[model samples]
Target: MASIQFKNVVKKYIQGKQSLQVIHGVNAEIADGEFIVIVGPSGCGKSTLLRMVAGLEEISGGEISIGSRVVNKLEPAERDIAMVFQNYALYPHMSVFDNMAYGLKIAKVPKDEIKARVDKAAGILELGQLLDRKPRQLSGGQRQRVAMGRAIVRQPQVFLFDEPLSNLDAKLRAQTRLEIQKLHRELGITSLFVTHDQVEAMTLAQRMIVMNAGNMEQFGTPEEVYSRPATTFVASFIGSPPMNLLKNAPGGKPGQLLGIRPEHLDIGTEGWSLVVDTVELLGAERLVHARVGDELVIIRTHEDQGAPAIGSTIRAKPREDRQHWYDASTGKRVGP
Candidate 1:
């Protein structure tokens, strides 16, 4: 395991004499054995940053270090890192055992040592029984595990996963997520995972980096980011239905944005009267969509609480302590 550091890393692409900057100065410290997720919307540079760490993309400015060594100019293989790509990247003609043993073979490791390592990784990944199967013979989740098995055998200082769960069905994605968490626990390897899924970021990450258009928005534990968003972008992005950021919101001063989470709002007798636009009954909870002034507000309620009729007026209030204030011009958080 190793600590990874990014010191004002930057990336730029030159196209027809135009230099388009994709990643701004991104800086963060990942501790040894920590799992960090880089999450953002598509085109937001999450994958770009991960690729830079893997040496798949070049750094345009600043430095990246693994452990105490500055790896800015080091080749990918020399950095001692293992990567699990989204597509599994398994060879169709090769069996699971051969695929996992390929890297060690290329390095010319002794035959006995290679078998021991492959067997160990396969055992850990529960692929021991499927060692002779080709890529086409395995299910999506099984193929993904084989890809992970390939990486585990390398025993690198760091592990890089690039949307490794995207191809799986929803049920399999959830199952594989739990398996990855277990793997991290048992092996305690430093891992950096990149994905566009906020749920994955919140669930899998010990800490996470939230980005937007190449700029780092916020980096923290899921609780901190969700509870106290540093900026409007994070406030709107991290939540399921998203938080309500109203311009000239009720009980807010002019030129300030009032923010409140859906669950932090409640139907009450005194407060803003919301004109109901729609209501969605989720399994255990209900989501009510209504308009306050000219802004839409979403309120989460227990299904047992029932729901108001569409087009009817419902009174609601935001929990006093849960209110978030933001600067209207900068869109950054401010004191209430």
Candidate 2:
């Protein structure tokens, strides 16, 4: 296992003669065996940062160190990191055993050691019986496991995953997530996973780096990022339905925006007047979309609490304890 340190890392692209710097000088520290996720929307620098760590992309400035060794100048193989890609890049004709063994074979590792590593990886990934089967014969999740097994046999200092579950279906994605968690617990390898999905980041990360438009937005545990967003972008991006930012609303100061999560809005008979626009029943709970003045807001209420009718006027207010304040001018969090 290895700890990764990023010191003011930057990336730039030369579009003709003009240089466009996408990743700013982003700094972060990831402890040994920590599963860190770099998360943001599309076009954000999350993948670029991960690629830099993997030595797949050139670092325009600053330094990246893995295990106290600066690896900015190292080759991908010399970095001692194994990356699992989004596409599950497996050889179509190769059996699962051969696929997992291919890397070790190329490295000229002893046949017995390769076999030992492959067998151990197969058992850990629950692909023991499927080792003889070719990639073409395996299911999507099975193929994904094969890809992971291939990486596992390497026994690298760090593990890098680039949206590895994006191709899986919803059910498979959830199941694969559990498998990944179990794998991490068993192997205890330092991992860096990149994803645009906020839910994945919140669930999987021990600590996550949130990015926005090439800027580092916030870096914290899920709870800290969710409850105490350092910036307005984090407050609005980390949640499911997302936190609401009410501009010029009641209880908000001038030049500041009021931030409250949908689940934090209490529905009652007396408070801000909201015209219910729609109600979405989601099994045990419901989401109430309502118009409060000109801005629309969503409130999550349990089914037992009852759903309000559409087009009905209701009263809802942001919970004082859950309120977050952001600077209107800079979109950064203002007060606790």
Candidate 3:
């Protein structure tokens, strides 16, 4: 296992006389055996940053060090890292065992050692019974496991996953997440995973990097980012229903915005008056979408609280300790 470091990392694309900067001076220290996730919306450069670590993308400036080596000039193979891509790139004709052992075979490892490594990986991934089956014969989840098994056989110092769970169904994605957690716990290899899904980042990351518009908005554990976001962007982007940023909140400061999570608001008799626009029942919870002045706000309520009628006027109080204050002009968190 090895630690990864990024020092003033930057990326830019040149088209004729114009240079478009995509990643702006990102710095992070990933400890040995830590699982980190880079998460953001599309066009946010999260994948670009992961590719830079994989040696697939060139760094326009700054240095990336893996372990004790500066790997800016090193080829992907020379960096001692294994990558599991989104698409399962297994050869169609090769059986699972052959696919897992192919890299070791090319490296001229002994046949006995190759078999041992493949066997071990197969057992860990629970692919021992399907080792002789071709990729076409396996389900999507099984094929993904084979891809992961191939990476495990290499035993690289670090692992890079590029949205590996995007292709799986919801149930399969949840199951595979558990499998991945187990894999990390057993191998204890340093891993960096890239995803646009906030749920995946929250669940899998020991620490997460939230990116926005070529800049890193925040890097911290899931609890920290969700509880106390650094900027309004982080506050709004990291949550499911998203944090509500109200410009005309009751008793609000003149130049500041008040932010609150949907769950942090309580239906009360004395507070901001809201006109209900819609109500959605999601399993055991209810979401009340309402308009407060011109701004829309969502309040999460338990099913036991009952749903309010559309067009009905109600009062919702923001939790005193849970409210977030941000600078209206800069959209940055302003107060403690």
Candidate 4:
């Protein structure tokens, strides 16, 4: 386990007298055994940042350290980091045991120690029985487990996961997420996971870094990013169904934009008059898509709760003090 620190790190790609900056002077501190997830849309440089930490991408400026060692100049292998890729990247012909043991073998670890580590990781990932199977013989979830097992055997200072579950089905993704959380608890290895999925970041991260356009937008606990967004981009990006932002609405006070989560907006008889456009019943809950003033807002409610008919007007407001204010010009959060 190790504490990871990034001190004003920057990365730029040079192309024929032109330089495109991908990461702009980012700084962060991750405590030992902490799970940090970097999340953002594509082209936001979240993956680039994670690769830098793993020593896969060179830092253009500033420093990166693992534990007490500055690893900016260290080779990826010497950085003592294990990365699990999105594609799993397992050899097609190798058995699971061999795949997991390859790293330890290359490092020239004792055979007995390699056996011990492989067995432990396979057991933790519930892949022990499939150790003799090749990548072609396993399902997507199984293949993902092998990738994780490969990383665990290294017992590196930090574990890096680059969208490791994106290839799985929804059910498999959720189940794998639980498995990962359990594995993290069991091993307590410092982990940095990068994903574009807000759900994964919210569920897996003790802390999350939200990046946008080559810059750090917000870094905080999932709750902080959701409940009190530091920026409008964060408020919009971090939630499922996304937060509803209403501009120029007639309310208690004049505001540029009002942000509220779908779950917080209630179907009521006394608020902004909304023209119900659609109601999507989702088993235990429903997502009501409607128009409030000139803005589209989504309201989530229990499945038992009824929604107004299409083309009908209804009243809606936040269930609690869940409204957020954002500056119209800068898209930054303002006073509630």
lDDT values of the candidates?
A: 0.94, 0.94, 0.95, 0.90
Residue clash pairs of candidate 3: none
Candidate 2 lDDT (Cα, 0 to 1): 0.94
* Candidate with better TM-score, 2 vs 4: 2
Model 1 local distance difference test score? 0.94
Clash list (residue pairs), candidate 1: none
Q: Put down candidate 4 lDDT per residue, 1-336, tens digits, no spaces.
A: 899999999999999999999899999999999999999999899999999988889999999999999999999988889999999999998999999999889889999999999999999999989999999999999999999999999888899999999999999999999999999999999999999999999999999999999889999999999999988899889888888877765573464677889888777778778898999988888888988767788989997777669899988868657878888878888874
Alpha-carbon deviation at 222 in model 2, angstroms:
0.6
Off by over 4 Å in 2: none
Clashes of each: 0, 0, 0, 0
For 1-336, candidate 2 gives per-residue lDDT tens digits of 899999999999988999999999999999999999999999999999999999999999999999989999999999999999999989988899999999999999999999999999999999999999999999999999999999999999999999999999999999999999999999999999999998899889999999999999999999999999998899889998999988967666999998989999999976799999999999999999998889989999999999898899999978888888888999998865
lDDT of 3 by residue, 1-336 (tens): 899999999999999999999999999999999999999999999999999999999999999999999999999999999999999999998999999999999999999999999999999899999999999999889999999999999999999999999999999999999899999999999999999999999999999999999899999999999999999999999998999999999899999999999999999897889999999999999999999999999999999999999999999999999999999999899877
Q: Stretches of candidate 3 above 4 Å error?
A: none
Off by over 4 Å in 4: 252-255
How high is each candidate's TM-score? Answer: 0.98, 0.98, 0.98, 0.96
Q: Summarize candidate 1's per-residue lDDT along 1-336 as a digit string, tens digits.
A: 899999999999988989999999999999999999999999999999989889999999999999999998999999999999998999899999999999999999999999999999888889999999999999999999999999999989999999999999999999999989999999999999999999999999999999999999999999999999999999999999999999967778788899999999989897888999999999999999999888899999998898899999999988999999999999999963
> Candidate 2 versus the native: TM-score?
0.98
RMSD of each: 1.0, 0.9, 0.8, 1.5
Q: Pairing residues by index, what is the TM-score of model 4?
A: 0.96
